[model samples]
Target: MFPPTPPIPEELTLVVDGLTYAGLAFGPVDAPPVLALHGWQDNANSFLQLARALPDVRLVALDLSGHGQSSHRSADATYQIWDDLPQLVGVLDALGWAQCAVLGHSRGAIIATLLAATQPERVHTLITLDSMLPRPAKDEDFAKTLRAFLKDRTALLNRSPRQFASEQAFVERRARMGEPPLVSTVLADRALKPCDDGFAHRNDPRHNGASAVRMNEGQCISVLQALAMPVLNIWATPRQGLEDDIARQRALIAENVPNVTSVDIPGHHHWHMEPEPAEQIAAAIRHFLV
Candidate 1:
């Protein structure tokens, strides 16, 4: 059986903090709203395939700060939990939406979970794709990670942007990065745009550096405990684990959050974009929303 085709939506931009962030809004304006957030190094367009598979819901997907068509900050600001709050709220206000259900992938999932926890009344329900509660790093490992991030940060700041000779050259280079077939296709579609100088990725390279923010396990648990809204947790198959730790974390969330459901979608971490996995996620969202 074929899934009903969702109405094709138009793209637009919303300005927040002097930055114009691009986004897509679909379905009827008055329909129950679903805010879809993309992962690190991804843009709003990443949700296109999944959004098209769902029905009778308003789906809004935004390019996060410093990614896609959004404006980048001049200073090296650490992209912290607080940074997302303003933008999320701004988006809702601009759309005249008082509350929304959220669907987030990876880093976007973390932000969505935090928002649902901190401001429960603003969220109807939450869905997190291939993301776990934030975990604290051991002091030694944390320091090592910080040092490595700083070294890369300095290198990125000093480096000049490079231009590809052609779109095919850039796409060929991307193919060598070992992305899953479906994810690579989605990425190839969204990340490249034609310019007079051939095709270039729309996102800023600084987004890679912005991803270094850290939060501890205790803080994550506190947020989970605070969540009063329903949540759907989706995990991808090639598990990232020490089984004991994973079990412990799941138990903690199940106990703390009032209405929590979990699903293991079959695919790698980037499954949200793969055809089968994306359909599964869309179905899950439709079920929860209805």
Candidate 2:
């Protein structure tokens, strides 16, 4: 059975480009790190339940730029998938960590895939939860995608975040986003911040903008094929087209990478936030690492 959640981890910060990146560090101080990266709009606390269940390995969950107490990017900068690589590497160098395992969810999983491919020496194993390398960019949609990206950027760049009257209102508002709605209170631990009027979410409005450039299917495969480390991919029930695409990519990884394990589990995308799935997922990771 799942145990009570552990105490909050110690707060840590890594500065890159003079901007502060916030993180939560748990487990032994000297153990090789198992870097935990949250998906878009989620914060370091997204890994709280997972970290609590994984005591054998050190886990450090980062809020990636613009999400939590971490500093927002320069106004001219965009949060492209590739843009995070160098800075993430900077985080490793700053911490004096030469090598470690990477546990990433969603957008962070894409980063982990890229990091392991590009900087194989720094990452030992790659564990992804409900996500994988990004979808390939289509040549036919380049102009359309760019137009959409600019339109969205213009609409979102100057907008201010909505202030919620109360935490309950905030939680309910988030539930309206889609199916298998995440637990609002669990999300609020990192998503909400007190404001003079009420509570405002810490997310950057610009994060809603789509990327102007994306990798093609072949390019994505090349990156995954480059990985010299073991890969563990966890999946929730398929949501249709997107999940099918990931399955195709996983097939490629299975064919190329020396070791690859894919597990299908029951839960929504935010499964790691729930006690039951988080416990199961952590047990799987604990066994994988050993």
Candidate 3:
């Protein structure tokens, strides 16, 4: 059986610019906070295992816009990798945190990197799990990317939320969508909601559409180079098709970022969610934060 989940996290709501964000807070309220962000299709509970491992460090894990209990962006907006930036800043200001450590997994890791790069003064320590930069696209693919994004967007807009027979079935279906092949029930609970019969997803459908735009390698490099804050990049063994991107970004970070500590650990991309890997990751983070 999996390690027991920590106590039910305290519920929290942060509002900024008329938008409200829902999140879970763990550990002592007085401890210096580490704003935690989850990956694509994941939510605040993504950090549960890690939070349990690091009981002394306060973790405020937010369900980003379009995901979990958070509000979706206005109809005019799109889920670009950078779209969450201003909202995150607003969340920090609302929390009265001028500067604090930040932790992100997958898509969240990309956002944390963007935050550290654009608002260097507000992040003291950066810890990225299994990812650091956005997937880069080539300049020649811009038109194709835009067209494909539009098509996907239109298609998804006309679709209705799909309900599953049971939460377990939904979790199994989700696990089949990617590598590691494991799903946490805690995460499933946060990502799902009861509907007419079984359960419907809580995530915004737009999240499944292709991004209208993406930063190219050169752009990603500039962002990586701009990271002046101390960073702890904890990456798992890359999945089959990710080897190239992983190698490429590691090279870029090794060459450009001066104060980064890169560590390779075992497990798949969501390693931080499992007990043993979470403990290992906690040790690295604890050492880095100290």
Candidate 4:
């Protein structure tokens, strides 16, 4: 059994294309809306502390499809990063919002960039944490990657979701799977759910598959070049060889995007989950959004 979650104020639900997307909301409802999005496998809870740190604005952090409590896409649908943009736009439109600021982390940030660049009027400001793009297409062997994607997708469909002895163990299991934080609380916050037999993760396993196709560097550069919004990129220090790549991405954005402000914050990929780093993120957001 899992321990009870401490009370989170303002539970939210967004129904899009007949699917339910669950989230947590904070601050005043009438304030300029800011939609917060979590990364790959991360849920809406990723923004819990960050929302608490920024009470001056309305923040609604949603569990992107197949993560957290959000409904999974149909079996035929792929979980490509670009597929999230229309659903995201639909959510804001359903909320009667013509335009709203977007705050996304890692994979979610890629979606934000896509939205801001392609549909410029729909996004007010763009803020990303830790990553720019997932695997760039330029560096990929598409034939090999597509084959792996098919294999993994088919495998997941036939396999049952993994179960755990207890929710705490499930959280501990997840902590070891990623870039791993020294503390488990952040991942633990949205990592598990009760299942028929035992506790299991909330994310869909199909997400483990390789991308069927990816945005090549040129495509990514074109989008970054078109962005006219005030963009804030709060990046974390990547591990060794990864640092140079992120620096290159940052330089690309700075060169192309008209109004871009970037700052390096401490901690690993999911730094926004911790209080200290969340505060740093909030400060940058406050400065940029203003």
Candidate 5:
């Protein structure tokens, strides 16, 4: 049928701001470089399927801070979206890449959007899977949002990691959380760490905390308008269709960005992590890059 699946990628580690970032690097060293950013709660392995689909492009997928084998941030450091910029810059510096394409999924996609808008010169091409930007905040709800965030921050500070009795238990739990078994198994391989009692997730508890703030509508529009490089916005068309707000925002982004190509493929939110959809997405990315 298709080309044989690619082998597991080589592990890579980069130190930035005293934090160790873990990732997987694949494809030829001389091919066009593309940074891959996975969604929230997902590790570098999220791109495994997509990597298997596209053997021509060089891809480096990171676990980002607080996720997978990456070192967690200091106790005082927050997990805000913008807080990742410095680490990203460091990763780029380590790779000696002055400019390259970026591929992001869900939460990672939003971060990529922000990066493309704020540091347009460093990102030559942007490809976002199933997201454009974070949910916009309303002025009227600012106070309430701040209070909730503070409460969440305090509540999760002392929370303990959840453990699973066995490997199957962990995979089943992850499956119940929405991912298919195939996808869950791939993710569980990296997300689960052996403990005294059982295996527990390695992600930082603070990663589950609420964000302190989100950009407002006008601010998001400004970001959309700031994208000067070619952008491929690929979103899944769920059976229920896109949510009104998300659809509206996606439309707004496409309208504001000068060189954006929008493609809606049939699948769910984590479609890029699935076998069939990953093929379709990889094809779209390959064509877009060309």
Candidate 6:
């Protein structure tokens, strides 16, 4: 089992262009900081388990602008991978951190790569977990996937606050959906907020449908080539067809970047949520950083 959630030193907010990002800080503030970024549909709390495992390091995790406790931007808000750079910069500035390491998962990993590439001086180290360069869209399949992702967002946005006839009903449905089982209990505890109407999802679905900028192979190669920081790329084994892809990705990184290392952790993509594998990930990170 995972350790209990560590006590947060404090809850804080960083306001960027009138939008508020809710976050928590852990470990010693004086230590060289590490920013933790979660994957799509996940929040800052996603890092809690890992944070507990790496108690010696100062860590800051935030709800990206539409997830967790962060406020949703206007419907016209332009959301894209590049847009996140400034937000991250702003967070660092708010914390008075000039340089820090980054640990990102999935989408966050892509963003970290871009940031380290473009702003090499600001990012000292980067670690990507279970992430890959965005797959290039070919023909209609690209459109299909984008449409499906957007449709889910639209539905979530239009959903009315559901009042579970019973807590068991909600639990049963969530299980059926196969939502990451390991963190379901933790997620359930944090997903709801008491209201006059009983309970409502604290997460904003409008943020869910935010527009994404697709990165092609050339773009991905360019970004990796530009990275100057030491990088540790971790892949999850048993990932469908990913073993082959990871081999290619490693070659690309090794050939282009001066300092790069790779590791393949056993398990599925969401290994961080699983207790045993998460420990391995934590151990790997600790070893790499040292």
Q: Rate the local accuracy (lDDT) of all candidates.
A: 0.74, 0.83, 0.87, 0.79, 0.87, 0.74
| Per-prediction TM-score to the true structure, in the order listed | 0.87, 0.94, 0.96, 0.92, 0.96, 0.84
Which regions of candidate 2 are displaced past 4 Å? Answer: 179-182, 238-243
lDDT of 1 by residue, 60-106 (tens): 98888767666765565655545777778878888888899988898
- In model 1, the worst 10-residue window by lDDT is 1-10
Q: Candidate 4's error at 258, in angstroms? A: 1.8
TM-score for candidate 1: 0.87
Q: Residues 63-143, candidate 3, lDDT per residue (tens digit)?
A: 999889998878778898899899999999988899989999999999999999999999988999999988789999999
How many steric clashes does model 6 contain?
A: 0
How does residue 217 of candidate 1 score in lDDT? 67
TM-score for candidate 6: 0.84
lDDT of 2 by residue, 185-238 (tens): 766766778999889988888888888778887888788788889888888775
Instruction: Report the lDDT tens digits of candidate 4 across residue range 1-290.
Output: 11133235588898988778888888788998998888987888788778877878888889899887888888899898898878888898877888889888998998888888887798878888887656457555778878888988998865666777786676567668764553355655556777877777777888878888877778888888878888888888755668677777777887778888888887788888777777888888888877
lDDT string, candidate 6, 41-130, tens digits = 677777777777888889898777766688776755545667678878888888898999998888888778878888888899999998
lDDT of 5 at 131: 90
The Cα RMSD in angstroms, rounded to one decimal, for candidate 6 relative to the true structure is 3.4
The 10 consecutive residues of candidate 6 with the worst lDDT sum are: 162-171
List where candidate 4 sits over 4 angstroms from the true fold. Answer: 1-7, 178-184
Judging by lDDT, tell me the better candidate of 2 and 6: 2
Off by over 4 Å in 3: 1-4, 179-184
Poorly placed runs, candidate 1 (over 4 Å): 1-7, 139-146, 166-171, 195-197, 210-213, 240-249
